[model samples]
Target: MCELLGMSANVPTDICFSFTGLIQRGGNTGPHKDGWGITFYEGKGFRTFKDPQPSCDSKIAELVQNYPIKSRAVVSHIRQANRGQVNLENTHPFTRELWGRYWTFAHNGQLTDYQKLNTGHFRPVGETDSELSFCWLLQKLEQRFPEPPQDMEAMFAYVAECCDELRELGVYNMLLSDGEYVMTYCTNHLYWITRKAPFGKATLLDEDVTINFQEETTPNDVVSVVATQPLTGNETWHRMKPGEYNLFHFGERVGGNVDELADVAFAEAKPKSQAPTEPL
Candidate 1:
């Protein structure tokens, strides 16, 4: 399995504090090391950095740790590859163009026998199952809606339906963003923490570092962080159930519910083999 990290904020905010702890898990604190990648969205433009090396040791990851690039939405991943070779193309947090926007996605679970799905609009550049799933998702989205929906409720429902199909294959926790907002789904484990008026110190669970956000953030700032597991030891994170999905915009939760997308039949559809042979 892999780990996912995502962010959505009312104000432009850097992910350094939370990312430092997450990178440590790539090799230092956990064994998810295969490759790691991150994306920072600044308006319509995006800046991304990736490395096949472990995040704990990758100089690129170190640079990300120091860079204060700000964004309203972001998606990142630490890969424990299930399908595909350990190469740049195999990294998670893959990107594609959709509705004239750069849509990014990252997966934290394996999908067995998922290659059966047909991707109509998007195609995979890499051989990873994660990328395959992403391509298929976008393809279906395009087919369902020839253009971006004027109704967000319908769009969110379609996205949830795609996630449900993937969830049937296996553990399918994922994060997706279109540079403005974030959509997250949980098939097993995922938690989220939101920071608002009452800023405080946050201690990393993987790294021995703590940050006092109050010193740097404004009273009106609101930032939300989503991760496979809780990163901070002090924050009160909301835990998502097995079949759950959440939509966040400007750091506030728009709509979410486990019951909205829950389907017990899909859980039973999980492939018998969820574990991989080795990382990548």
Candidate 2:
């Protein structure tokens, strides 16, 4: 298994605070220590960094923590090596060019009998089942739509359909983006939080660090973070149900199988801090 972290913002935003907690899980606070990688989508340009070493000890991870590269859509992953060797090629988040955009993908779960899917034009550069799934997903999309669809919602529905098929094989939680919108699918566990006006302080669950976002963000800024678990101890996070698919663009949720739940919508919801009880 693995863990995923993603960000979608109305304006360019840095994910240092959330990433700090996530990296700790890669080796320090959690067991997913095989490798880690992250991708940042800034306008039409993007940057990616990956390492086969444990994120808790990797100098590359340290540099990522200190660097404040801002972007609208970002995807990250920390792997536990369930289906691939511990190497850079096996690390996520994987990237490919599609529709003249840099599309990134990261998976947090494994699939059984995943080799049955056709790879089409996109081929896996790594031996991981995660990469196989990613290539297959893109192949399916390419076969269905030779060009980016004019109606984005229709495309989202198609992606959800593809995800549903994957879920039939095994756990299929994933995050995908193409500089425009971030699409997330949950087969078992995933959570998200959005920050807007009247920002507040948040303390990291994996470190003794705190940040007052009110001072760091303007009133008009809107930022959203999605992770396998809640990254902050003090913020209210929305838990995605099994079989849920959500899409966020420009920091605001625009499409999904479920209605977009605002930050306040989950204000009174109880925390799902207990280990996941749902079957994978």
Candidate 3:
């Protein structure tokens, strides 16, 4: 299995605080030490940092922790290597170009018969089931809509349906983004928390670090974080149901497969938290 971390913010924000806790799990506080990678979306383009070494010890990981690369949407993963060999190409947070946009994907679980899934034109560069699944998904989307769909909510719903089919094979927790919106699907474990005005202090669960977000954010900032597990013990993270799917844009939960009531509840929820402040 692997661990996933993602962010969608109204303003460009850095994920240093949450990332610091996640990296510690790569070899220190947790056992997902095979490799790790992170992608930060800046405008229409994005950049990624990957390493086959344990994130807790990798210098590259250290740089990402210290450097605040601000992004509107972010996807990151720490792997435990159940399917593929430990290497850079096999790292999580795989990327592909679709509809002239760079789409990033990361998976936290495994599948049994993923190789049977036809990828069509898109193909996997790595041996992991996660990569294969990602390619297959893109192929399907391309087949259905040669160009990007105008109805993004419908497109995201289709993605959730695809994820459901994949879950039939095995566990399929995932985070996917295309610089604008982040889509998440869960078959096992996934949690999320949104923060806005009147920010509060948060302490990391894996490390001895505390941050008072109020001192670092404006009154209008809205930021949402999604992860395989709660990164902070002090915050109240909403746990996604086993078969739930969610969609987020500009730090707000816009749509998903959940009932209308649940969607409304999330949309009208009070503002809650901050990521990091620094130039990209």
Q: Give me the candidate number with maximum lDDT.
A: 3
- Runs in model 2 deviating more than 4 A are 262-280
Over the stretch 1-280, how does candidate 3's per-residue lDDT look in tens digits? 8899999999999999999999999999899999999999999899999999999999999999999999989999999999989998999899999889899999999899888999998989889999999999999999998998999889989999999999999999999999999999999888888888778877677887778788878989999999888887666677788779889998998987675245221222222233233201
Can you list the residue pairs that collide in candidate 3?
195-272, 195-273, 196-272, 196-273
Q: Against the hidden reference, what TM-scores do the models get?
A: 0.91, 0.93, 0.92
Clashing pairs in 1: none
Stretches of candidate 1 off by over 4 Å are 258-280
Error of 3 at 31 (Å): 0.3
Evaluated at residue 14, the lDDT of candidate 1 is 91
Clashing pairs in 2: none
* Model 2: number of backbone collisions: 0
* Model 3 misplacement above 4 A: 259-280
Q: Per-residue lDDT for 21 in model 2?
A: 90
Tens-digit lDDT track for model 2 on 1-280?
Answer: 8999999999999989888999999889999899999999988878999998899998999999999999999999999999978998999999998888888999988899999989887989889888999899889988899997788778878988999999999999999999889989999879888788878777777877778788799999999888998887667778888789889988988888876653232333232343222211
What Cα-based lDDT does every candidate model obtain? 0.83, 0.86, 0.88
